[model samples]
Target: MKRICSIYKSPRKREMYLYVDKREALSRVPEGLLSVFGPPQHVFDLLLTPERTLAREDIHKVLANLEQQGYHLQMPPPEEEYIEHLPDELLRRNDPV
Candidate 1:
């Protein structure tokens, strides 16, 4: 299956994103989720296909969510994951110079 998908970033949380069908937009996302997710900032639109690959999301799962629930939520990577990638300078900020 092929679909045009729109991606939105969460203003309240870094690295959190929401994906939905371009045609359906955000209408299908529930108010509860929207409240927690904050107002979505339009990021970009992409044409998705079975053969396509996404940097952070599973393409198949995203498409399935769009088909079934009309939306896909991409939560931020865990805090540990972020710590692991922190620059040495930042990690050493508390250390003596």
Candidate 2:
């Protein structure tokens, strides 16, 4: 049976639900899976799963789609130093348990 998860976004009170297979759920969950609450990107990032590269082209495509649908999104934040790929030596030293 496929277990569906419903995440309630507080302060906003938005409910988002997704149905995924068990294997996918196991691989994608963070240690505190039930407590996670945020946008899709934030949620996935907290889970420490591999993130899809959200490149400039992807942003442009999204803008285009939104405009076509008559939706105007707020300006994107300026790019700051985002560390994605860390050196193995660093991971080894930081490893817990």
Candidate 3:
């Protein structure tokens, strides 16, 4: 099936996004979900298909959720290891007791 979708970003979180039918828009998202998701920022509109590939999500799953629940939530990517970003001296000093 082919669907025209609108994607929205979370103002409060990076790399977080929401996708829904363009015609329905925000009306279909749950209030509790919106409460924590914060206000929606329009990202872009796109056509979704089973064969389409998302940058960080499964196209089939996204489309399935959108079909079943009226929307799809894309969470932020997993954070890198804190130690990987820490200064060498900091990691060395905190290595072991």
> In lDDT terms, which candidate is top?
1
Q: Which pairs clash in model 2?
A: none
Q: Give each model's whole-structure lDDT.
A: 0.94, 0.32, 0.92
TM-score of each: 0.82, 0.18, 0.85
Give one digit per residue, the lDDT tens place, for model 1 in 1-97.
Answer: 9999999999999999999999999999999999999999999999999999999889999999999999999999777766665887586896887
- Name model 3 segments beyond 4 Å from true: 82-97
* Tens-place lDDT digits, model 3, residues 1-97: 9999999999988989999999999888999999989999998999999988989999999999998999999999887887666798687898888
**Local distance difference test, candidate 2:** 0.32
Q: Rank all candidate structures by their TM-score, best first, as comma-separated numbers.
A: 3, 1, 2
- lDDT at position 81, candidate 2: 39
| Deviation (Å) of 3 in candidate 1 | 0.6
- How many backbone clashes does every candidate have? 0, 0, 0
What is the lDDT for 2 in model 1? 99
Runs in model 2 deviating more than 4 A are 1-13, 37-97
Model 2: weakest 10-residue lDDT segment is 41-50
Query: Regarding TM-score, does 2 or 3 come out ahead?
Result: 3
